[model samples]
Target: EKWAATRAKYPPTTLALQHFDAAYGIQLGHLWPSVRAALLCERKYGALVNNFSDDDVLSDLQDQGCRDFISDTDLEVHLEQISAVGVEGESSDLSTKTSDISHQQLSPLQISRNIKCLVFPRGDITRFKPAKPDKFGLLGYYLMDAASVLPCLALDVQEGHNVLDLCAAPGGKTLTLLQTQCLGFLCVNDSSISRTLRLKRVLHSYTPKPFLSGDNLRITSFDGTKWGEIERDTFDRVLVDVPCTTDRHSLVEDDNNIFSRSRTGERRRLPQLQLELLLAGIEATHPGGEILYSTCTLSQTQNQSVVEQAIHLAQENHSIHLQVVDLKPLTHMFRKTFHFAPNLHLGEMVIPHLAANFGPIYMCKLKRLT
Candidate 1:
């Protein structure tokens, strides 16, 4: 009733609340009042607090009964208080250590070349110039960053682990795991046989290691969802980078009428299909393994909501415990937007404005607790 009243009072603010409820199945009435109050206060007192320093205004506001007049300094003080209370900052020095370890793992040649490429423009490189465009056929493509491939690679892929890339084709992330040189076998499956063959050609370019060679890497054509029924808990890691509405790529929209309807339908249908795919991926994932769920869309229905639903379903079935790895630090640095789920233990979201190139990719890394 309170929620209904609040929604009636402020229609626009309630829209996000309604969307959140529909998407994640959580009722957050207590938080709504505070959120609404904050919005109202922000509108009423924002200008006064906007430029005020801690000493100049927040102290005054507190004494004057405007407790929520949060200035930049007030935010800093709050964080300091929280830090004093032992709440962890999103990125600690541990991230630096991990980054250093990642650097150390790279060969000197790789590091030097990476640094040189960053310092010198690509076309100016002396060893090999950027390839000229092939007029005859498409030869190469570009992705925003290699970091986008990291989640799929870091998924519970260990030495001698059997992995499945359900819907894998044009293999950017599939190749990331192959490069790890750790997996026992990689089953790269796609619905399209032609695309799977293309994936094979791409994987074939890399020198086959003992773990990732001819027999270790198998390309098959199959509907991904059926894998659950055919082979349950068979893979140590599963990558379900599902198809989604490519609205972020609106610049490439060829036909407005067709594209808009398709995009809308994709947006509506994605959450349910994504939830199914994730559940199937989890079914394929061995106990104590992980699955990386990703999409190149910004929709909450496709990203966090689907993950939450999967987690709930998994809990009901006692199949696996979902642990969400925090991608907040990564998203913050990259300026990505994430629509957070109330109950998520871990996840990452990359919004459109953040990426320099193609984007608004949402990714979540989930581990199945044994």
Candidate 2:
């Protein structure tokens, strides 16, 4: 009855809560309220410094409650190939070392230990909403959850790699990929024209005018699931951050939400679509290439089940093989900055907490072998 009353009070969040209750509320237990209550407060967000340009200084963001680096601690890797881990009993090395990420930069505030994103605690969002320029002119940082940037980092983009961001829209992870400055060619695409336009605009904000349209970068409105046919075995790295329920935003905002009355069918079909996208991403990956599959929601069906099915289908139909890259080492290294969900077979989920309110972002890494 109280939940009914609260739902009546906030119609925007009702459908999401109901769906969550049906989906995984039993697992959430008391943490469900933590997610609910955290929604009422300002969100803790992070800033990714623009590696492309230095025209704008943003030191004032640190004063505005930006506390520390996402992970300043040295990562001690204790990860073995995740056994059975829900994907079947096969195991493979996740393949990363503490020495790989131990490099430090001169910046004391945010050591450039590979991932240069900054963490801001709650009650510290005044700088992001209106985007406070502060005393250092325009802020040089791109405001986002520190968690959303993980997939791009884990994708391990390198110089001269031909990269494809298949479902890239509103383009946040795309920007993080750009920060690497390692791409020989980048194709950013989405099925939605509006989203593709928004992605183009996001690129425009951070990218130089000349570089946005040349031989290096290309933007298109393509059916993300059909990408394998369009560019077969082409990219060195691929990022398929598929469109999911967007659980956190779905609860807070009602406009065009998947939980809404108009989109119930769309929501139901998401797992199938996610599975197709992952398969297509794998198909587009060159032999010995890597791909990072991600979503911004917590639906188990949309995440692990989809990856499991894709793994099954990829080998069964096309004779392609994918090695699931274990991410336990990465999650543990940044434990202080993120609250990761336990026992997940395919990926890492940053569970939202009232104290550390961020995410519900799930990412799984894979490598395609011919």
Candidate 3:
């Protein structure tokens, strides 16, 4: 009852409507009657619009010739704005047209099976039940979505391009990069040896190849902070998915008992480590290559602040520059809490409310321009 009252009292404002119209070159008053009606109702009647059913309000607008609603362009712009506002990440103007890499030589059954496992899988009923399910993955486990994984997978990883996955164990993002089948030689390192072995087990589930079967893929047990000892500019693409406070997960479960003090510590410790890992990843990345830094937390300190710090470090020591990628179209729900630094551009933080399946995850794609 308390939750319901809180919700009812603080409904989301529709500020995006104005921004949407402005972005798409649509006249707010004339585009859709329903939208216009809602606007006028909110302006004149104020509290009355809250009582009206969404269907009724929309139907009334439709009847009034508000047919030309915002287009996909507007939707994309609105989504970008929200994500930009929520997290300090910049959205790229990169085209969505992906290249066809599907191999025709593989049998149809094999292809179908691979696609099924890659895209969708039906498991036993028992798999659906969690043994120790928290909103976020516990300890070395992390549940991530395509928004965080896709950009890493799409990078052009040519032959002989060294790659690194710092803090990679129970590796989902690491697996995505491997699936691209482009790394010259891959290094999958994690601080936990047991988790690294678990990652090996997960990799075994996929089809075996020279990369998987041979020593081409190196699995190391080491701290990510020490990864800077590796030769500078050695990797083509480096992934830094750091550990964070997991505050967003707090909303889904009653973990007050276990997380109370630890959560506070995480808020402080995560930003420091995040910035360190990014510096290590940037140093490890080949000049003109890309580094993707991600975290499964929502704090601006861990997300925006770390990226800004890395950019500053790069400017001071190396000639590296950071380019931001926009992530608005994919994350539509949480636009309110996004924050950014005035000087630094690129990277984003996903808020808890925006994610449908996972807790908040922040991602930043940066190209090393030296």
Best by TM-score: 2
User: Candidate 2 has what TM-score?
Assistant: 0.83
Candidate 2, 123-233: lDDT as tens digits:
344446434333323336677877898777677776688999999988888887877665789999999999899988778777666567668899999898998788888
Report how far residue 159 has shifted in candidate 1, in Å: 2.7
Ranking by lDDT: 2, 1, 3
Model 3 RMSD vs true structure: 15.4
Better of 1 and 3 by lDDT: 1
lDDT of each: 0.50, 0.73, 0.49
**Candidate 3 residue lDDT tens string, 204-263:** 543244557556788888888777786578888788888775433332333441134434
Q: Estimate the Cα RMSD of every predicted model relative to the unseen true structure.
A: 16.2, 5.4, 15.4
Off by over 4 Å in 2: 1-12, 29-31, 56-58, 67-71, 75-115, 121-139
Give the best candidate by lDDT. Answer: 2
**Cα-lDDT of candidate 2:** 0.73
What is candidate 1's local distance difference test score? 0.50
Taking all chains together, each candidate's TM-score versus the true structure is 0.57, 0.83, 0.56
Superposed model 1: Cα runs more than 4 Å off: 1-86, 89-147, 153-156, 206-214, 255-267, 328-346
> What RMSD value applies to candidate 1?
16.2
